[model samples]
Target: MLRRKQHRFQHNREAHNVIERGKELYTTIKGHWQEYFKNDNPLVLELACGKGEYTVGLAENRPDVNLIGVDIKGDRIARGSKRCIEKGLTNAAFLRTSIQYMDEFFEEGSVDEIWLIHPDPQPRDKEEKRRLTNPHFLTEYKKYLKPGGLFILKTDSPFLYEYTLEKLKEFDGYEILDHTNDLYQSPLLKDHFGIETHYEKLWVDKGYTINYIKCRVQ
Candidate 1:
């Protein structure tokens, strides 16, 4: 029993490494994270990356970019990171942390591009602060996105999409390239969903409209 407990304890530690690293990895990598990877790859971030579905898919398709999946849930992080490891992908990384503390991890104008896929809309009035497209979070993203870095947001919520569109007009650091109700009808929707994760495929099956946008951060 003691040996079993010890093994379980070790297991939990490995599972929580993303969370632990999320808290402290940035301070050490402030100006030198790229050195550790030893290559000139574009830094791509998937914010609120549940299960890292998109991150893993993107890394699989594009070997030229370094993909980082960020989420706050341990279970999701474990599943996502484990999948990446199973695929033997060196270009992908996962971090467990809240969006509120993102500035700590990314230096100003460091990220080359960003992806926000299926982020919780938090429709409740009180939870409006939790919306990933809230002006505050946009500001945080702007700080990390390099000049002209691409910011892509894909969701099923029309409310969130319309809200984001209105805000982008007033926001300082973005140029909205495409805003659409159905991604399939648009010629720009290149099957970016690699493994389909779980939700993206489900949404497609249910006939939910998938909205997408590609914004260039100014």
Candidate 2:
């Protein structure tokens, strides 16, 4: 309970990088990102960004782009926001909100890239629609991602990897750019692959083969 209060305090106190619930900015920041970042850089989003590992990593790697981490957990978002503030990173920000309301926060064709890092597989047959790569989510992505924008998924679940592949195949105008059932063994591994999220490290330590897919929506 004390830790929750601390997180809430920190999350509310930090306005430079955190955009939490109950703020006017939460509803008004849709197309006014340039005013926030003070630049016209490409926009990238990390959905369900628990602790914002990818958001901070990508912001550090690509200063030319603006990255926003979106998640509903304020405590988790607080951690990432604190890290960004400590690192003095202006390109990284956190939005405390549910991923289902993504369209309300971003304009159509405004996102240049999106990363889904180790999202929950929602493995049960009845939970298929809740998977991040479900057709519904793909359509939501399509609504904001620019033409030829990249949609990258990194996961430790074979079920999700295969499910995403099947959905992408069925989805219109989604072109697969690269994929690997085992990311570390594949040549598709890039420099940014070195940044591992907390959950990713746990999965790797358990000898899970990380699956990765990169696609473009046309």
Candidate 3:
């Protein structure tokens, strides 16, 4: 494990698509996002992007929108960044950082949308604050999202699905766009449901149903 991690770290150092600690402009990437992509297109964030399946897939299909896959693991970032360069994808990049500090990297109202794809459910009652759909994380996400921007979540945890719905009811600044306990059984929205993460596939193969929630931040 140590050797593999070291190898990934070295590769990340040489990757232009991968940005990690010690990068000069890592903290101030928010206002300069368009300049980084060399375009004024809308920005989309994929939080907790492991292997960056959704990030790479979305960027490939939607060249008009820039996608940044955010995760703390150097190994995961290396995998995604390498794929982006190999595929010649200009619209996708990977950021190695804790999701708790997203506001430091993106300016308020800078992001057009956010994808909380298959994030940790934090199933225990004591860990509720750490859940991505918790009120605290929702507030952090809203800081970067544009007015009326979409906050989309896809998960396989029933606890998380119910928790998110309850939190959304308590928060007055957001309105539910749509939600489903079983994504495959309901009418599918192609754009949001098309990209599947590695963990998502594993859960589905084990007969677990996926849940999704879409809300607009006011």
Candidate 4:
């Protein structure tokens, strides 16, 4: 496992679709991705994009938009980046970086939409600050999202679903577009909600209900 990880890290650095940390350009500007992808398409991000199923899948369907999969795991990034190349997906890229430093790579108001698909819920009360849908993370996201940008959260954790719903209520500049504790049972059968991650499928097979929330950051 260790050897495979090391090899993947090295291989990812050479993949055009993969961007690793310590890249000088990443430290400087946020909108550099436009130049990288060589287009003016709206940017969409899949946070904690393990193996980039959402990023690659969305890019395949939405060629009009550019997609970036952000995750810290180089091994998973290698798989996603490799698939992007094999499929000739120019609009899809993988960024091997922690979500905590997203602001450093994106310009203010640059992002058009964000998909937090099956992110770590940080279920413990003491880890509330680490929850991706919590205030701290939401504040960071708001800084880079354009006005009226959408945030889509999909999870199997009931705690996170309820917690995020309450947080949205207290947040001043955002409004809940829609939410459902049982995604499969909801009327939404397509688009972002229809796109499933590996973890999502596993949860579904285990008889866990998937919860989803869509909010517009004003």
- Which lDDT values do the candidates have, in the order given? 0.77, 0.88, 0.87, 0.86
- In model 3, which regions exceed 4 Å deviation? none
Residues 1-218, model 1: lDDT tens digits: 66655653344357523434534554665555587456878899998897788888898899888888888765666666777777888888776678787776778888998899988878778997889998988888888999989888888888888888888899986999877878866776774743454777788889887888788987
TM-score of 3: 0.95
What is candidate 1's local distance difference test score? 0.77
lDDT of 4: 0.86
TM-score of each: 0.88, 0.95, 0.95, 0.94
Better-scoring candidate (lDDT), 3 or 4? 3
Model 2 worst lDDT run, 10 consecutive residues:
7-16
Q: Which stretches of candidate 2 lie over 4 Å from their true place?
A: 191-193
Clashing pairs in 3: none
Per-residue lDDT of model 2, residues 7-38, tens digit only:
66576566668886677888899899988899
lDDT of 3 by residue, 1-218 (tens): 89988988999887888878887668667689899999999999999998898899999999999999999998988888888898999999999999988867888889999998888898988988788888888888888889999999888989889989999989878889899999977785575637777777788889889998999999
Clashes of each: 0, 0, 0, 0
Q: Could you give candidate 4's per-residue lDDT for residues 67-161 as a string of tens digits?
A: 99999988997988888888999999988889998877888899999999888889989999889989988888888889999888988889899
